[model samples]
Target: MWLKLNKTFFGTGTHIYLCAVYIPPLNSTHTADDLLNLEAEIANYSKYGDIALIGDFNARTGEQADYIENENNSIQFLQDMLPQDYDLDSPIKRNNLDILNQQGNNLLNMCLSSRLRILNGRYLGDSLGYHTYFSKNGCSTVDYAILSKDLLPSVEYFCTSDLNFLSDHVQISFKLKCDIKQYINKKDFNNNNMKKFTTYRWTDVSHGKMYEALNSDEVKNKILNFEITHFVRNEKGINEASKSLTEILDNVASKTCIIKVPIKQKKSKIKKNPWSDNELKDLKSKINNLGKKTKT
Candidate 1:
């Protein structure tokens, strides 16, 4: 079995965890059964915050360029695994992108994130593609570098340069802040009493950039129009249900707020003597001053 270690290696909080996974090598041809297993694994693993599936998938980018047999089937494997909370980032179109047609090279290198926000429920792309490593035909490209949608806005730059002499494919690297603290804070905000008091304020402040991305008109429409289906089972009669925009939003909001409680110290029995007269007077004065400042 490929190893699946759970911990926040990049972000600060446990809410954002890095799920390091390694898939056992399979034949280079990429089989349907292999794809099915891959899909199941991804679905099982996606329960964690904004999953990022790194490492080789042994599939070619050509699979994404045009319809090949079983292409949607392959993508469906991944799509099914995505969290119900959000949509994965989609392919971004760039100017001067016709170069792919000129070079007969299709952008197969992909990075998917599910932390995307929806205006209407649709996801948007942030210009995802790959760079050529070399001019030669025998280039090797690492399979995938999926990201969480919420984390994509912070991406300063992403590139894969061609290494003509060292190897066929160029080495890929990206620079993004790995603020584990933020993730930890987010994780703790739901449970920490002190943090909860300030959580909404901090979240509003922090989400300025993230909200901008999700609130784009294009992004909102995509989310609103995305397809969904329902399956039902009944003993004697069957009732199928479908979710509307309002229903989906309400559901998502509820799930997002469900936080795990963190271990805490038992309340201390040690009690201070009733506040001294001077201390009480001083506290009263401070409170009055705070009230005055608020009025101002």
Candidate 2:
């Protein structure tokens, strides 16, 4: 099982967590404690984000007529384990049968307690009852697309299709009305386009020329002539003044200094290895000496 949080621009910083899971079959060697542990792990993950746990849980949902052996403990455990935010409502409104089994009853009770409406039940009414899984035994709705209550409004459509040619389970599809925004880092904006000042490495020859330019009569008169009051009045005026100053400095630097292209250094890769007990002891000794050296 794994959880992936996807950020979208529904409002701002809206995240939808997709939890993919596969619970072991009830008849398998997995014990009740194992199932409880799995549920605990899922519950922990749910606290971090809005989650949609989807997978073949192997627990029967009483949405079909097929009389397969029910895993009562697993069914009840999962229903009890899910957080309040999860929607337990069946997406399909009508099943092949009118009555629900033990698993269905437990699921229904869970939904009622959580106040979660089923997406499939809401979209597909009694007339469009569909089965998700098929085999020699019979057709049943085993697979499900569960979502959080917050995501209920964003669900545009939800229905099952007959796309499973090789597999026993059919494909369940749903569309979400959401706008995804691409994440941009602030550091990416610090490129050459944003740079206004020309950078130069200071040397003895360049430093002497820069000193002469700053103290020159022409440069001093230009600085004196610049109107500080005109620039301080508004935002646009300040930008214009800054641009003019940058131009002046760039001209002076070109005349007084030699422009050198910056050298790009290749980063060295450091490989890490697990340290043995002796190595750890040696490292501790080094750290103790460093503290003594600092004191001295």
Query: How many clashes does each candidate structure show, in the order listed?
Result: 16, 8
Name the best candidate (by lDDT).
Answer: 2
Give one digit per residue, the lDDT tens place, for model 1 in 1-296.
23333346455232443334333334435344544454455455557544444444433332232212344456666776767774334443332121332112221222212232111001122133443333445432333444555555555555544454434545544455556564465654454565333111224333454455456675466456644343344522222233444454443333334333444568979654685577787898999999999999
RMSD of each: 20.5, 27.9
Q: Report the number of the highest-TM-score candidate.
A: 2
| Candidate 2 residue 90 C-alpha distance from true site, Å | 13
lDDT of 2 by residue, 82-104 (tens): 78675333333434322354544
Question: What TM-score does prediction 1 earn?
Answer: 0.34
- For candidate 2, the TM-score is 0.44
For model 1, state the Cα shift of residue 97 in Å. 6.2
TM-scores of the models, in the order given: 0.34, 0.44
Model 1 regions more than 4 Å off: 1-10, 13-32, 58-143, 180-296
Position 142, candidate 2: lDDT: 53
